[model samples]
Target: MIQDITTSIRTTVVLWLLTALIYPLLILVIGQGIFPAQANGSLIVNDQGQVIGSTLIGQAFSSEEYFWSRPSAVDYSIGEAAAPTGLSGATNLAPSNPDLLALTEERAEILQAANIAPTADLLYSSGSGLDPHISPASAIAQIDRIAAVRNLSLDDLQTLITQNTEGRFLGIFGEPAVNTVTLNLSLDQR
Candidate 1:
Protein backbone atom coordinates (compact mmCIF):
# COMPACT_ATOMS: atom_id res chain seq x y z
CA MET A 1 0.00 0.00 0.00
CA ILE A 2 2.84 2.44 0.89
CA GLN A 3 4.60 1.68 -2.41
CA ASP A 4 1.46 2.41 -4.41
CA ILE A 5 0.88 5.67 -2.52
CA THR A 6 4.48 6.83 -3.08
CA THR A 7 4.27 6.07 -6.81
CA SER A 8 1.02 8.02 -7.07
CA ILE A 9 2.56 10.97 -5.24
CA ARG A 10 5.65 10.92 -7.47
CA THR A 11 3.52 10.90 -10.63
CA THR A 12 1.43 13.79 -9.38
CA VAL A 13 4.52 15.84 -8.54
CA VAL A 14 6.05 15.26 -11.96
CA LEU A 15 2.84 16.28 -13.78
CA TRP A 16 2.43 19.40 -11.64
CA LEU A 17 6.02 20.47 -12.30
CA LEU A 18 5.62 20.06 -16.03
CA THR A 19 2.36 21.97 -16.14
CA ALA A 20 3.32 24.77 -13.73
CA LEU A 21 6.72 25.56 -15.22
CA ILE A 22 7.59 23.92 -18.54
CA TYR A 23 4.23 24.49 -20.18
CA PRO A 24 3.97 28.18 -19.34
CA LEU A 25 7.57 28.86 -20.29
CA LEU A 26 7.07 27.15 -23.61
CA ILE A 27 3.95 29.19 -24.36
CA LEU A 28 5.73 32.40 -23.44
CA VAL A 29 8.65 31.62 -25.72
CA ILE A 30 6.38 30.75 -28.62
CA GLY A 31 4.11 33.74 -28.12
CA GLN A 32 6.98 36.20 -27.87
CA GLY A 33 8.49 34.94 -31.06
CA ILE A 34 5.20 34.64 -32.92
CA PHE A 35 3.72 38.03 -31.97
CA PRO A 36 6.28 40.29 -30.37
CA ALA A 37 4.28 43.49 -30.71
CA GLN A 38 1.03 42.00 -29.40
CA ALA A 39 2.88 40.10 -26.68
CA ASN A 40 3.98 43.51 -25.41
CA GLY A 41 0.36 44.79 -25.23
CA SER A 42 0.52 46.61 -28.63
CA LEU A 43 1.63 49.92 -27.15
CA ILE A 44 1.62 53.01 -29.38
CA VAL A 45 4.51 55.44 -29.44
CA ASN A 46 4.76 59.00 -30.61
CA ASP A 47 7.35 60.24 -33.13
CA GLN A 48 9.62 61.03 -30.19
CA GLY A 49 9.56 57.33 -29.30
CA GLN A 50 7.87 58.08 -25.99
CA VAL A 51 5.43 55.46 -24.78
CA ILE A 52 1.88 56.75 -25.06
CA GLY A 53 -0.52 53.96 -24.22
CA SER A 54 -1.93 50.70 -25.47
CA THR A 55 -4.09 50.60 -28.58
CA LEU A 56 -6.38 48.04 -26.97
CA ILE A 57 -7.86 50.19 -24.21
CA GLY A 58 -9.98 53.35 -24.44
CA GLN A 59 -9.05 56.65 -22.79
CA ALA A 60 -11.16 59.60 -21.79
CA PHE A 61 -10.35 62.87 -23.58
CA SER A 62 -12.89 65.53 -22.63
CA SER A 63 -11.04 68.51 -24.02
CA GLU A 64 -12.28 69.92 -27.32
CA GLU A 65 -8.78 70.03 -28.72
CA TYR A 66 -8.73 66.26 -28.94
CA PHE A 67 -11.44 64.09 -30.43
CA TRP A 68 -13.26 62.26 -27.66
CA SER A 69 -14.09 58.58 -27.44
CA ARG A 70 -17.38 57.02 -26.45
CA PRO A 71 -18.70 57.70 -23.00
CA SER A 72 -17.10 55.20 -20.67
CA ALA A 73 -19.28 53.16 -18.38
CA VAL A 74 -16.31 52.91 -16.03
CA ASP A 75 -17.17 56.24 -14.42
CA TYR A 76 -13.84 57.32 -15.89
CA SER A 77 -12.12 55.92 -12.81
CA ILE A 78 -8.65 54.49 -12.75
CA GLY A 79 -6.87 51.62 -10.99
CA GLU A 80 -7.69 47.93 -11.11
CA ALA A 81 -10.67 48.29 -8.84
CA ALA A 82 -12.28 50.15 -11.74
CA ALA A 83 -13.06 46.76 -13.22
CA PRO A 84 -16.56 47.37 -14.53
CA THR A 85 -19.49 46.58 -12.32
CA GLY A 86 -23.23 46.06 -12.73
CA LEU A 87 -24.56 45.13 -16.12
CA SER A 88 -22.37 46.22 -19.01
CA GLY A 89 -25.09 48.48 -20.36
CA ALA A 90 -26.62 51.87 -20.38
CA THR A 91 -28.55 52.74 -17.22
CA ASN A 92 -31.71 51.96 -19.27
CA LEU A 93 -33.38 54.68 -17.32
CA ALA A 94 -36.85 55.57 -18.54
CA PRO A 95 -37.54 58.78 -20.44
CA SER A 96 -39.35 59.73 -17.28
CA ASN A 97 -36.35 58.74 -15.16
CA PRO A 98 -35.33 62.16 -13.92
CA ASP A 99 -31.69 61.16 -13.81
CA LEU A 100 -31.79 59.93 -17.39
CA LEU A 101 -33.52 63.06 -18.64
CA ALA A 102 -31.04 65.24 -16.78
CA LEU A 103 -28.03 63.40 -18.23
CA THR A 104 -29.38 63.68 -21.77
CA GLU A 105 -30.03 67.37 -21.33
CA GLU A 106 -26.55 67.94 -19.96
CA ARG A 107 -24.92 66.09 -22.85
CA ALA A 108 -26.99 67.93 -25.41
CA GLU A 109 -26.10 71.26 -23.86
CA ILE A 110 -22.43 70.40 -23.94
CA LEU A 111 -22.63 69.38 -27.59
CA GLN A 112 -24.48 72.55 -28.55
CA ALA A 113 -21.96 74.66 -26.67
CA ALA A 114 -19.19 73.09 -28.72
CA ASN A 115 -21.20 73.36 -31.94
CA ILE A 116 -21.06 69.62 -32.31
CA ALA A 117 -23.96 67.63 -33.76
CA PRO A 118 -24.31 64.69 -31.40
CA THR A 119 -24.58 61.27 -33.00
CA ALA A 120 -26.23 58.25 -31.41
CA ASP A 121 -22.89 56.52 -30.88
CA LEU A 122 -21.70 59.45 -28.79
CA LEU A 123 -24.44 58.90 -26.23
CA TYR A 124 -23.80 55.22 -25.46
CA SER A 125 -20.98 53.44 -23.69
CA SER A 126 -19.37 50.37 -25.27
CA GLY A 127 -19.85 46.99 -23.68
CA SER A 128 -16.24 46.79 -22.50
CA GLY A 129 -16.06 50.44 -21.52
CA LEU A 130 -12.65 50.01 -23.12
CA ASP A 131 -13.49 50.33 -26.81
CA PRO A 132 -10.62 52.09 -28.57
CA HIS A 133 -12.43 53.16 -31.71
CA ILE A 134 -15.42 55.32 -32.56
CA SER A 135 -17.91 55.29 -35.37
CA PRO A 136 -17.01 57.45 -38.35
CA ALA A 137 -20.17 59.47 -37.72
CA SER A 138 -18.96 60.28 -34.23
CA ALA A 139 -15.60 61.42 -35.57
CA ILE A 140 -17.23 63.57 -38.21
CA ALA A 141 -19.53 65.11 -35.62
CA GLN A 142 -16.48 66.44 -33.77
CA ILE A 143 -14.87 67.95 -36.84
CA ASP A 144 -16.09 71.44 -35.97
CA ARG A 145 -14.65 71.24 -32.46
CA ILE A 146 -11.30 69.91 -33.62
CA ALA A 147 -11.01 72.24 -36.61
CA ALA A 148 -11.86 75.34 -34.59
CA VAL A 149 -9.42 74.45 -31.84
CA ARG A 150 -6.62 73.72 -34.29
CA ASN A 151 -7.40 76.77 -36.43
CA LEU A 152 -7.65 74.59 -39.49
CA SER A 153 -10.20 74.62 -42.29
CA LEU A 154 -13.22 72.35 -42.13
CA ASP A 155 -12.28 70.78 -45.47
CA ASP A 156 -8.76 70.03 -44.27
CA LEU A 157 -10.08 68.55 -41.05
CA GLN A 158 -12.55 66.36 -42.89
CA THR A 159 -9.81 65.22 -45.24
CA LEU A 160 -7.64 64.32 -42.27
CA ILE A 161 -10.48 62.35 -40.76
CA THR A 162 -11.07 60.57 -44.05
CA GLN A 163 -7.42 59.61 -44.19
CA ASN A 164 -7.56 58.17 -40.69
CA THR A 165 -10.72 56.15 -41.16
CA GLU A 166 -10.01 52.45 -41.24
CA GLY A 167 -12.16 50.08 -43.24
CA ARG A 168 -13.67 46.88 -41.95
CA PHE A 169 -11.23 44.03 -41.43
CA LEU A 170 -10.79 41.94 -44.61
CA GLY A 171 -13.31 44.33 -46.16
CA ILE A 172 -16.11 42.40 -44.53
CA PHE A 173 -15.81 41.69 -40.84
CA GLY A 174 -16.63 44.42 -38.28
CA GLU A 175 -17.69 47.98 -39.00
CA PRO A 176 -15.44 50.78 -40.16
CA ALA A 177 -14.01 52.76 -37.26
CA VAL A 178 -11.62 55.55 -36.44
CA ASN A 179 -9.06 55.14 -33.71
CA THR A 180 -9.54 58.21 -31.53
CA VAL A 181 -5.93 58.49 -30.38
CA THR A 182 -4.38 57.85 -33.77
CA LEU A 183 -6.68 60.31 -35.50
CA ASN A 184 -6.09 62.99 -32.85
CA LEU A 185 -2.33 62.55 -33.16
CA SER A 186 -2.55 62.78 -36.94
CA LEU A 187 -4.57 65.97 -36.54
CA ASP A 188 -1.64 67.59 -34.73
CA GLN A 189 0.46 66.83 -37.81
CA ARG A 190 -2.01 68.81 -39.93
Candidate 2:
Protein backbone atom coordinates (compact mmCIF):
# COMPACT_ATOMS: atom_id res chain seq x y z
CA MET A 1 0.00 0.00 0.00
CA ILE A 2 2.78 2.46 0.97
CA GLN A 3 4.77 1.81 -2.20
CA ASP A 4 1.71 2.27 -4.37
CA ILE A 5 0.87 5.59 -2.71
CA THR A 6 4.43 6.85 -3.09
CA THR A 7 4.52 5.92 -6.76
CA SER A 8 1.21 7.62 -7.40
CA ILE A 9 2.35 10.88 -5.75
CA ARG A 10 5.59 10.85 -7.72
CA THR A 11 3.78 10.35 -11.01
CA THR A 12 1.36 13.13 -10.26
CA VAL A 13 4.11 15.56 -9.30
CA VAL A 14 6.21 14.72 -12.34
CA LEU A 15 3.30 15.17 -14.71
CA TRP A 16 2.28 18.41 -13.04
CA LEU A 17 5.75 19.95 -13.35
CA LEU A 18 6.12 18.80 -16.92
CA THR A 19 2.80 20.14 -18.04
CA ALA A 20 2.43 23.23 -15.82
CA LEU A 21 5.96 24.59 -15.80
CA ILE A 22 8.49 23.09 -18.20
CA TYR A 23 6.10 22.75 -21.12
CA PRO A 24 4.94 26.35 -21.09
CA LEU A 25 8.47 27.70 -20.54
CA LEU A 26 9.79 25.66 -23.42
CA ILE A 27 7.01 26.82 -25.72
CA LEU A 28 7.48 30.45 -24.74
CA VAL A 29 11.22 30.25 -25.40
CA ILE A 30 10.72 28.63 -28.76
CA GLY A 31 7.96 31.03 -29.78
CA GLN A 32 9.87 34.14 -28.77
CA GLY A 33 13.06 33.03 -30.43
CA ILE A 34 11.70 31.67 -33.68
CA PHE A 35 8.90 34.20 -34.35
CA PRO A 36 9.50 37.32 -32.31
CA ALA A 37 7.12 39.59 -34.21
CA GLN A 38 4.27 37.11 -34.15
CA ALA A 39 5.05 36.22 -30.55
CA ASN A 40 4.52 39.89 -29.81
CA GLY A 41 0.98 39.78 -31.25
CA SER A 42 1.68 40.60 -34.95
CA LEU A 43 1.14 44.31 -34.35
CA ILE A 44 1.21 46.75 -37.27
CA VAL A 45 2.68 50.25 -37.26
CA ASN A 46 2.31 53.33 -39.41
CA ASP A 47 4.75 55.94 -40.82
CA GLN A 48 5.10 57.81 -37.53
CA GLY A 49 5.64 54.50 -35.71
CA GLN A 50 2.29 54.55 -34.03
CA VAL A 51 0.83 51.08 -33.41
CA ILE A 52 -2.35 50.71 -35.44
CA GLY A 53 -3.66 47.16 -35.55
CA SER A 54 -2.54 43.63 -36.24
CA THR A 55 -2.32 41.61 -39.43
CA LEU A 56 -4.08 38.64 -37.85
CA ILE A 57 -7.09 40.54 -36.50
CA GLY A 58 -10.01 42.57 -37.85
CA GLN A 59 -11.27 46.05 -37.13
CA ALA A 60 -14.46 47.81 -38.10
CA PHE A 61 -14.33 50.56 -40.72
CA SER A 62 -17.78 52.02 -41.35
CA SER A 63 -16.69 55.28 -42.91
CA GLU A 64 -17.63 55.68 -46.56
CA GLU A 65 -14.05 56.33 -47.52
CA TYR A 66 -12.90 53.08 -45.94
CA PHE A 67 -13.76 49.42 -46.40
CA TRP A 68 -15.68 47.68 -43.67
CA SER A 69 -14.99 44.39 -41.98
CA ARG A 70 -17.60 41.65 -41.97
CA PRO A 71 -20.42 42.34 -39.53
CA SER A 72 -19.17 41.40 -36.09
CA ALA A 73 -21.30 39.71 -33.49
CA VAL A 74 -19.46 41.78 -30.93
CA ASP A 75 -20.73 45.17 -31.99
CA TYR A 76 -19.38 48.39 -30.51
CA SER A 77 -18.88 52.00 -31.58
CA ILE A 78 -15.13 51.78 -32.10
CA GLY A 79 -16.16 48.83 -34.24
CA GLU A 80 -14.31 45.52 -34.38
CA ALA A 81 -11.91 44.54 -31.68
CA ALA A 82 -8.20 44.63 -32.58
CA ALA A 83 -6.94 41.56 -30.80
CA PRO A 84 -7.13 38.28 -32.72
CA THR A 85 -10.69 37.11 -32.37
CA GLY A 86 -10.79 39.31 -29.34
CA LEU A 87 -13.96 39.01 -27.31
CA SER A 88 -15.75 37.23 -30.15
CA GLY A 89 -18.82 35.04 -30.17
CA ALA A 90 -21.63 34.13 -32.49
CA THR A 91 -25.14 35.30 -31.75
CA ASN A 92 -25.98 31.60 -32.20
CA LEU A 93 -29.20 32.56 -33.88
CA ALA A 94 -30.64 30.03 -36.24
CA PRO A 95 -31.01 30.98 -39.90
CA SER A 96 -34.75 31.44 -39.58
CA ASN A 97 -34.62 33.41 -36.36
CA PRO A 98 -36.73 36.55 -36.57
CA ASP A 99 -34.20 38.69 -34.72
CA LEU A 100 -31.55 37.65 -37.20
CA LEU A 101 -33.84 38.57 -40.06
CA ALA A 102 -34.50 41.97 -38.54
CA LEU A 103 -30.81 42.68 -38.05
CA THR A 104 -30.10 41.60 -41.61
CA GLU A 105 -32.83 43.86 -42.91
CA GLU A 106 -31.46 46.75 -40.94
CA ARG A 107 -27.98 46.13 -42.29
CA ALA A 108 -29.33 45.85 -45.83
CA GLU A 109 -31.12 49.14 -45.47
CA ILE A 110 -27.97 50.78 -44.24
CA LEU A 111 -26.02 49.49 -47.21
CA GLN A 112 -28.81 50.47 -49.60
CA ALA A 113 -28.75 53.95 -48.14
CA ALA A 114 -25.10 54.12 -49.24
CA ASN A 115 -25.97 52.57 -52.59
CA ILE A 116 -23.76 49.60 -51.92
CA ALA A 117 -24.98 46.16 -52.88
CA PRO A 118 -25.52 44.00 -49.84
CA THR A 119 -24.06 40.52 -49.93
CA ALA A 120 -24.30 37.54 -47.61
CA ASP A 121 -21.03 38.54 -46.01
CA LEU A 122 -22.61 41.82 -45.04
CA LEU A 123 -25.65 40.22 -43.50
CA TYR A 124 -24.07 37.31 -41.65
CA SER A 125 -21.61 37.27 -38.79
CA SER A 126 -18.45 35.29 -39.36
CA GLY A 127 -17.98 32.10 -37.40
CA SER A 128 -15.28 33.68 -35.32
CA GLY A 129 -16.95 37.06 -35.27
CA LEU A 130 -13.38 38.32 -35.69
CA ASP A 131 -12.45 37.21 -39.17
CA PRO A 132 -9.93 39.74 -40.49
CA HIS A 133 -10.71 38.99 -44.10
CA ILE A 134 -13.76 38.95 -46.35
CA SER A 135 -14.49 37.30 -49.65
CA PRO A 136 -13.01 39.17 -52.62
CA ALA A 137 -16.46 39.27 -54.16
CA SER A 138 -17.78 41.11 -51.14
CA ALA A 139 -14.96 43.63 -51.38
CA ILE A 140 -15.61 44.14 -55.04
CA ALA A 141 -19.27 44.83 -54.46
CA GLN A 142 -18.40 47.84 -52.31
CA ILE A 143 -15.91 49.34 -54.76
CA ASP A 144 -18.31 51.81 -56.31
CA ARG A 145 -19.31 53.24 -52.97
CA ILE A 146 -15.73 53.52 -51.79
CA ALA A 147 -14.69 55.13 -55.04
CA ALA A 148 -17.47 57.69 -54.94
CA VAL A 149 -16.86 58.51 -51.29
CA ARG A 150 -13.08 58.80 -51.47
CA ASN A 151 -13.21 60.68 -54.76
CA LEU A 152 -10.67 58.22 -56.05
CA SER A 153 -10.88 56.60 -59.45
CA LEU A 154 -12.68 53.26 -59.58
CA ASP A 155 -9.77 51.80 -61.48
CA ASP A 156 -7.34 52.78 -58.75
CA LEU A 157 -9.51 51.41 -56.01
CA GLN A 158 -10.01 48.17 -57.92
CA THR A 159 -6.29 47.90 -58.47
CA LEU A 160 -5.64 48.52 -54.80
CA ILE A 161 -8.13 45.85 -53.85
CA THR A 162 -6.57 43.42 -56.27
CA GLN A 163 -3.15 44.11 -54.87
CA ASN A 164 -4.23 43.45 -51.31
CA THR A 165 -6.25 40.35 -52.02
CA GLU A 166 -4.67 37.02 -51.07
CA GLY A 167 -5.04 33.69 -52.73
CA ARG A 168 -5.72 30.51 -50.82
CA PHE A 169 -2.95 28.67 -49.01
CA LEU A 170 -0.52 27.10 -51.50
CA GLY A 171 -2.96 28.36 -54.18
CA ILE A 172 -5.58 25.71 -53.58
CA PHE A 173 -7.16 25.70 -50.16
CA GLY A 174 -9.82 28.22 -49.16
CA GLU A 175 -11.32 30.89 -51.38
CA PRO A 176 -9.53 34.16 -52.02
CA ALA A 177 -10.07 36.85 -49.43
CA VAL A 178 -9.08 40.42 -48.64
CA ASN A 179 -7.89 41.77 -45.34
CA THR A 180 -10.19 44.55 -44.25
CA VAL A 181 -7.95 46.55 -41.95
CA THR A 182 -4.92 46.19 -44.17
CA LEU A 183 -6.85 47.37 -47.21
CA ASN A 184 -8.05 50.41 -45.31
CA LEU A 185 -4.52 51.15 -44.15
CA SER A 186 -3.17 50.80 -47.66
CA LEU A 187 -5.83 53.23 -48.85
CA ASP A 188 -4.82 55.76 -46.23
CA GLN A 189 -1.11 55.53 -47.06
CA ARG A 190 -1.93 56.12 -50.71
Candidate 3:
Protein backbone atom coordinates (compact mmCIF):
# COMPACT_ATOMS: atom_id res chain seq x y z
CA MET A 1 0.00 0.00 0.00
CA ILE A 2 2.86 2.42 0.76
CA GLN A 3 4.55 1.58 -2.56
CA ASP A 4 1.35 2.20 -4.46
CA ILE A 5 0.86 5.54 -2.68
CA THR A 6 4.43 6.61 -3.48
CA THR A 7 4.10 5.73 -7.15
CA SER A 8 0.84 7.68 -7.46
CA ILE A 9 2.39 10.78 -5.91
CA ARG A 10 5.39 10.60 -8.24
CA THR A 11 3.24 10.13 -11.33
CA THR A 12 0.93 12.99 -10.42
CA VAL A 13 3.84 15.39 -9.88
CA VAL A 14 5.46 14.42 -13.19
CA LEU A 15 2.26 14.77 -15.18
CA TRP A 16 1.36 18.05 -13.51
CA LEU A 17 4.75 19.60 -14.34
CA LEU A 18 4.58 18.41 -17.94
CA THR A 19 1.08 19.76 -18.50
CA ALA A 20 1.05 22.88 -16.34
CA LEU A 21 4.55 24.16 -16.92
CA ILE A 22 6.75 22.63 -19.60
CA TYR A 23 4.12 21.99 -22.27
CA PRO A 24 2.59 25.48 -22.10
CA LEU A 25 5.98 27.15 -22.12
CA LEU A 26 7.03 25.24 -25.20
CA ILE A 27 3.82 26.11 -27.02
CA LEU A 28 4.07 29.81 -26.13
CA VAL A 29 7.64 30.04 -27.41
CA ILE A 30 6.81 28.19 -30.61
CA GLY A 31 3.66 30.22 -31.25
CA GLN A 32 5.35 33.57 -30.70
CA GLY A 33 8.34 32.60 -32.82
CA ILE A 34 6.37 31.19 -35.74
CA PHE A 35 3.38 33.57 -35.86
CA PRO A 36 4.24 36.77 -34.06
CA ALA A 37 1.42 38.85 -35.55
CA GLN A 38 -1.27 36.28 -34.81
CA ALA A 39 0.30 35.37 -31.46
CA ASN A 40 0.24 39.04 -30.54
CA GLY A 41 -3.52 39.17 -31.22
CA SER A 42 -3.72 39.98 -34.94
CA LEU A 43 -4.25 43.65 -34.23
CA ILE A 44 -4.98 46.08 -37.04
CA VAL A 45 -3.58 49.61 -36.98
CA ASN A 46 -4.76 52.72 -38.71
CA ASP A 47 -2.72 55.28 -40.68
CA GLN A 48 -1.94 57.29 -37.52
CA GLY A 49 -0.66 54.06 -35.89
CA GLN A 50 -3.62 53.73 -33.56
CA VAL A 51 -4.92 50.24 -32.91
CA ILE A 52 -8.30 49.90 -34.61
CA GLY A 53 -9.45 46.32 -34.14
CA SER A 54 -8.37 42.72 -34.48
CA THR A 55 -8.97 40.68 -37.59
CA LEU A 56 -10.28 37.80 -35.51
CA ILE A 57 -12.93 39.92 -33.74
CA GLY A 58 -15.86 41.99 -34.90
CA GLN A 59 -16.55 45.68 -34.21
CA ALA A 60 -19.70 47.68 -34.60
CA PHE A 61 -20.02 50.21 -37.45
CA SER A 62 -23.24 52.24 -37.50
CA SER A 63 -22.29 55.01 -39.89
CA GLU A 64 -24.23 55.00 -43.14
CA GLU A 65 -20.99 55.67 -45.01
CA TYR A 66 -19.35 52.58 -43.52
CA PHE A 67 -20.18 48.98 -44.23
CA TRP A 68 -21.60 47.33 -41.11
CA SER A 69 -20.77 44.04 -39.45
CA ARG A 70 -23.33 41.58 -38.14
CA PRO A 71 -25.31 43.00 -35.23
CA SER A 72 -23.24 42.18 -32.15
CA ALA A 73 -25.14 41.62 -28.94
CA VAL A 74 -21.97 42.60 -27.08
CA ASP A 75 -22.02 46.04 -25.56
CA TYR A 76 -19.21 48.39 -26.66
CA SER A 77 -19.86 50.88 -23.82
CA ILE A 78 -16.82 49.53 -21.99
CA GLY A 79 -13.94 50.76 -24.20
CA GLU A 80 -12.68 52.47 -27.32
CA ALA A 81 -11.50 49.19 -28.77
CA ALA A 82 -14.37 47.13 -30.16
CA ALA A 83 -12.82 43.75 -29.56
CA PRO A 84 -13.39 42.06 -26.20
CA THR A 85 -16.06 44.62 -25.49
CA GLY A 86 -18.81 42.47 -24.02
CA LEU A 87 -20.13 38.95 -23.66
CA SER A 88 -21.30 37.32 -26.88
CA GLY A 89 -24.59 35.45 -27.10
CA ALA A 90 -27.69 35.05 -29.22
CA THR A 91 -31.27 36.26 -28.73
CA ASN A 92 -32.29 32.57 -28.88
CA LEU A 93 -35.71 33.85 -29.87
CA ALA A 94 -37.79 31.57 -31.99
CA PRO A 95 -38.86 32.50 -35.55
CA SER A 96 -42.43 33.13 -34.38
CA ASN A 97 -41.42 35.13 -31.34
CA PRO A 98 -42.92 38.62 -31.28
CA ASP A 99 -39.71 40.15 -30.01
CA LEU A 100 -37.75 38.66 -32.86
CA LEU A 101 -40.26 39.84 -35.42
CA ALA A 102 -40.38 43.31 -33.89
CA LEU A 103 -36.59 43.58 -33.89
CA THR A 104 -36.48 42.53 -37.52
CA GLU A 105 -39.12 45.04 -38.47
CA GLU A 106 -37.30 47.78 -36.61
CA ARG A 107 -34.05 46.98 -38.40
CA ALA A 108 -35.81 46.88 -41.74
CA GLU A 109 -37.40 50.27 -41.12
CA ILE A 110 -34.01 51.76 -40.26
CA LEU A 111 -32.59 50.60 -43.57
CA GLN A 112 -35.66 51.63 -45.48
CA ALA A 113 -35.47 55.09 -43.93
CA ALA A 114 -32.02 55.29 -45.45
CA ASN A 115 -33.57 54.07 -48.72
CA ILE A 116 -31.65 50.78 -48.70
CA ALA A 117 -33.43 47.45 -48.88
CA PRO A 118 -32.10 45.44 -45.99
CA THR A 119 -31.16 41.86 -46.76
CA ALA A 120 -32.33 38.88 -44.75
CA ASP A 121 -29.02 38.81 -42.94
CA LEU A 122 -29.32 42.47 -41.97
CA LEU A 123 -32.58 41.66 -40.27
CA TYR A 124 -31.13 38.89 -38.10
CA SER A 125 -27.97 38.72 -36.03
CA SER A 126 -25.40 35.97 -36.51
CA GLY A 127 -25.12 33.00 -34.14
CA SER A 128 -22.08 34.20 -32.23
CA GLY A 129 -23.22 37.82 -32.36
CA LEU A 130 -19.48 38.41 -32.86
CA ASP A 131 -19.26 37.41 -36.49
CA PRO A 132 -17.19 40.06 -38.25
CA HIS A 133 -18.15 38.84 -41.68
CA ILE A 134 -21.42 39.13 -43.60
CA SER A 135 -22.52 37.40 -46.76
CA PRO A 136 -21.54 39.18 -49.97
CA ALA A 137 -25.26 39.56 -50.69
CA SER A 138 -25.76 41.39 -47.40
CA ALA A 139 -22.85 43.73 -48.11
CA ILE A 140 -24.10 44.39 -51.60
CA ALA A 141 -27.55 45.17 -50.23
CA GLN A 142 -26.22 48.27 -48.51
CA ILE A 143 -23.84 49.49 -51.20
CA ASP A 144 -26.18 52.11 -52.60
CA ARG A 145 -26.79 53.66 -49.19
CA ILE A 146 -23.09 53.67 -48.36
CA ALA A 147 -22.23 55.19 -51.73
CA ALA A 148 -24.83 57.90 -51.33
CA VAL A 149 -23.66 58.78 -47.86
CA ARG A 150 -19.96 58.69 -48.76
CA ASN A 151 -20.47 60.50 -52.07
CA LEU A 152 -18.58 57.76 -53.91
CA SER A 153 -19.49 56.24 -57.22
CA LEU A 154 -21.57 53.08 -57.13
CA ASP A 155 -19.23 51.30 -59.52
CA ASP A 156 -16.20 52.10 -57.39
CA LEU A 157 -18.03 50.92 -54.28
CA GLN A 158 -19.03 47.76 -56.07
CA THR A 159 -15.43 47.16 -57.06
CA LEU A 160 -14.34 47.66 -53.48
CA ILE A 161 -16.93 45.17 -52.28
CA THR A 162 -15.80 42.67 -54.88
CA GLN A 163 -12.20 43.14 -53.79
CA ASN A 164 -12.99 42.50 -50.12
CA THR A 165 -15.28 39.54 -50.68
CA GLU A 166 -13.68 36.36 -49.39
CA GLY A 167 -14.56 33.01 -50.88
CA ARG A 168 -15.59 30.03 -48.78
CA PHE A 169 -12.74 28.30 -46.99
CA LEU A 170 -10.98 26.21 -49.65
CA GLY A 171 -14.12 26.84 -51.74
CA ILE A 172 -15.99 24.26 -49.71
CA PHE A 173 -16.42 24.84 -46.01
CA GLY A 174 -18.31 27.88 -44.68
CA GLU A 175 -20.14 30.44 -46.76
CA PRO A 176 -18.66 33.29 -48.80
CA ALA A 177 -18.53 36.41 -46.71
CA VAL A 178 -16.81 39.79 -46.47
CA ASN A 179 -15.24 41.22 -43.34
CA THR A 180 -17.15 44.46 -42.78
CA VAL A 181 -14.54 45.94 -40.46
CA THR A 182 -11.79 45.40 -43.01
CA LEU A 183 -14.04 46.60 -45.79
CA ASN A 184 -14.83 49.82 -43.93
CA LEU A 185 -11.12 50.32 -43.19
CA SER A 186 -10.40 50.08 -46.90
CA LEU A 187 -13.17 52.59 -47.53
CA ASP A 188 -11.45 54.97 -45.15
CA GLN A 189 -8.39 54.72 -47.37
CA ARG A 190 -10.54 55.83 -50.28
Question: Looking at candidate 1, what is the lDDT of residue 34?
Answer: 99
lDDT: worst 10-residue window of model 1? 83-92
lDDT of 3 by residue, 90-183 (tens): 7899999999888889988987897767886677787777777888888888888888788999899889888888888888998888888788
Per-model CA lDDT versus the true structure: 0.78, 0.85, 0.81
- Candidate 1 residues lying further than 4 Å off, grouped into runs, are 1-19, 47-49, 75-98
Query: Clashing residue pairs, candidate 1?
Result: none
Model 2 C-alpha lDDT versus the unseen true structure: 0.85
TM per prediction: 0.73, 0.86, 0.87
Which pairs clash in the backbone of model 2?
Answer: none
Rank ordering of all candidates by lDDT, starting from the highest: 2, 3, 1
Q: Report backbone clashes per prediction.
A: 0, 0, 0
| RMSD in angstroms between candidate 1 and the native structure over all alpha carbons | 4.3
Reference-based TM-score, model 1 = 0.73
Which parts of model 2 have CA positions greater than 4 angstroms off? 76-86
**lDDT (10s digit) by residue, model 2, range 1-190:** 9999999999999999999999999999999999989999889998889998888777878888898778988762243453553486778999999999999999999988987788888778888777788888888888988888789998898888898898999989998889888899999988
lDDT, candidate 3, at 186: 89
Clashing pairs in 3: none
